[model samples]
Target: MRPGPSHLDTARAEIIVAEAGHRAAVDYVSRFGKWDARASVRQRPGRRLSGHRDELATPFPPELAPVAAHALVAGRGPDAVREVLTHSLYQYLHFTTELEELAVIPVVAKISRNRSGLDLPEAMRADAFKIYTDEAWHAQFSYDLVRQVERASGIAVRLPELPSFVERLDAVRASLDPAVRGLEALMFSIVSETLISSILADIPHDSRLPKAVRELVRDHAEDEGRHHAYFRQVLHAFWPALSARERRAVGPLLPQVVLAFLEPDYRAIGTALSAAGLAPDEVAQVMAESLPRRRVVDEVAGSAGSAVRYFTEVGALDDPATAEAFEASGLLLGAAR
Candidate 1:
């Protein structure tokens, strides 16, 4: 069967000419692309406490992760509790870092390798290379930090063979209609970058975290602020080029991608919790209670607001199927449970 005309096919020529500059992104990176994670910072005492306590004890938020939710785990004493949260931070950061290199870099490559596919300015293409380089370094810094924490804390990070996120992403991509399967991967990764950017921006300000930890997060955030803007531009520029059928195919999947990216893998959580001395059943119980579906929806929904708004603004939400999908995914009014 033949695909219908592009949603923006009528306007693609004008859109391309108008968006070709992507000049702000180029200028931003050129001016502020400072600091190399591996070489930019000095060694610290690897102190666990930011000032009085480890900020990681709170991680995402009290309501979201709530590591101390279980009656027994809550009473595990401050030391044990801190260890659990720290472990979560380590595993979560590691997973997100891997996503950057594995998923994000590939999206940039898709365009860089094909000018027609991207229909972007040369400056934007050049910036793609910079992003590829920047995200690679981000991954390296994350890996190095995990090892440093493990060595210093003596708590081995025994993560599962594969990060649950990668698995979730694969599952989502597979579930997508074949016509839009490829777009799913790239969009999911882009959306995840938006989510991670907010976290990286704030984690550095956490005085309760170790100095090196803060610096690591700070350095990464600096880069991501640039990336967040870059991807937003990409989304703005790319959406207009898609066919209406492609939008229908791609839009409904946004909520799925958002949920997949936002929800932590409870199995991974349990594994980390068990590694922190909790028994299997206890880990299971905590995981079950701590991440109820409602809580997950709320947290994920809240974090996904900006990305959702972006989609709507870009006319990705103009279709009924897309709006319905968002509602069903808890990203719109009267969302599904």
Candidate 2:
């Protein structure tokens, strides 16, 4: 049977947007993309630190970690704040790189490979390859920047394993039906890409961070902006291709993905607080009293809000099972209509 006029109209719009987005990605790569770390260092030079102590400050957004700023954590003073902030940023970037490497690129490559040339469309395949190349470079540069920070600041970096985004998603997958596991991974990766697109503005613009570090983040953001456009277009293509059951499976996973990346890791946060010399009791009080979990959930919802809307528009949130999962996850309450 022929698809209705609305379906045809949506499909036509998707084609036009996808083509335009592909051109933009290519233009970005050719015009402004940095292909070399060494060249980036040379072009954006003179990253020497001035001898001021107040110059160093939180790298991640302060609002995201209100507990860290509480007397329990930051009272240890600027050095302690810097230590926790540095570790937080380090682990986050590392997780981002790993997510790109393991979660994102593989899904894109697989979709491109499994789908026929006509099925995947040449424009998307071409852009996916470009994204793959660009994402790998992103991972490498993120690693290099961590080493640079560690050497410059003299703070060794270590973070625990379980709540790492990958591990968390893997746990989520273990609870899901086997057939939908790949969809979970693909959708989670989609959320990862979406989350970073918004976060890019927060880091690079912070004057408190080192110039080189800020530059690194700025460049990554520029590339990811292009990537986000591509993935948004991919979603335009993705949802229509799925079965009803598959869509239901994907919906439940959306909130999980958002919280995995957006929610602060209390285990890691607690460890950082301890390393900064906070007492065990203080850490518990700070986690309980200073930072409200509801506020954190609200913040996470705001960060991943766009992706949630996208999932809703795609018919994922229409399923009762999916809506319940989101509510149970506590990222989206009363979102169903």
Candidate 3:
């Protein structure tokens, strides 16, 4: 997912067409997709590590604090760093695989097969099929990389069987009225795709990470940039198709949807820290100090700024209840307009 200028151009073109009226833009995967030339699975790139040292040079970016911050305070050297990095990798792999398999594919399969209630264009539906391929490749490559990294680092992976986000998303879905319950996957899929993650944006550029790791992230980010554009168009089509009642029911769930993706998994982080040899009390202190309420709010708000604005553009925020929910969630606090 090493996004370059071309990816940006593709995204911009998609946005222009979507705004003009949800027409198909120049197809990224079809016209300019890197699947054949660059997808990790197709390309089958291998991990290139020095044979002398069995430990990873730096599995995760040290500059990425909270996790890295905890690593430093633990003072356990490479072992601590390795644990944090591997855990981070596991979390990422879990997100990539689970989201595709559970949350995204089900909704996308409906869209691709023209079974989703929305009246999407044939071109949009075709694009949905391509997204299915891309997401599958993403999950495949992510899994392959996890095994490669584990073998390389010799660190046992520690990950929750299900990521916290999935659990949280299920809880949100269960809490919804049955009338609008059907919209949970659709809405959350849109939010997940549209929300800009800093991890994807920043990781490829970080020089300290392993080449394979960086390449994998770069590939993922590049694809997600297109996905970000594509889903915005999906929303453009989807919002107009919803009835007022459905809109009212679903709009207030926007903040929770954003949070379901962006909020820090403190439990996962704590587990990672503890695995890194931080005493339980030390882990607690690090968790409390590194990721305070304000910082988490700020990061989530920042990442979610574009998605919120897109919802606003589509009139999801026009409803008083939806607007009030966003304000109460504080997702809009200091977020870019």
Q: Give the top-scoring candidate (TM-score).
A: 3
lDDT of 1 by residue, 225-251 (tens): 677777877777567656666777778
Q: Mind giving the per-residue lDDT tens digits that candidate 2 earns over 1-337?
A: 0111121221233222231122111111222234344233334432444434444465566654566678767667888777877777776667667877888888777655634211344445655666776777777877777776666677786666544666678777887778755556566667777664345777788776766667777877777776776676666556665556666666667777778777777787787677777889988888887558887776676666667666776667788988887777765542421
Per-model TM-score on C-alpha atoms: 0.80, 0.78, 0.85
lDDT values of the candidates?
0.65, 0.63, 0.74
Which residue pairs of candidate 2 clash? none
> Cα miss at 286, model 3 (Å)?
1.4
Better of 2 and 3 by lDDT: 3
Candidate 2 runs further than 4 Å off: 1-61, 112-118, 161-163, 196-198, 327-337
Q: Given candidate 2, what's the lDDT at residue 107?
A: 71
Comparing 1 with 3 on lDDT, the higher-scoring candidate is 3
TM-score of 2: 0.78
Poorest stretch of ten by lDDT in candidate 2: 1-10
Ranking by lDDT: 3, 1, 2
Q: TM-score for model 1? A: 0.80
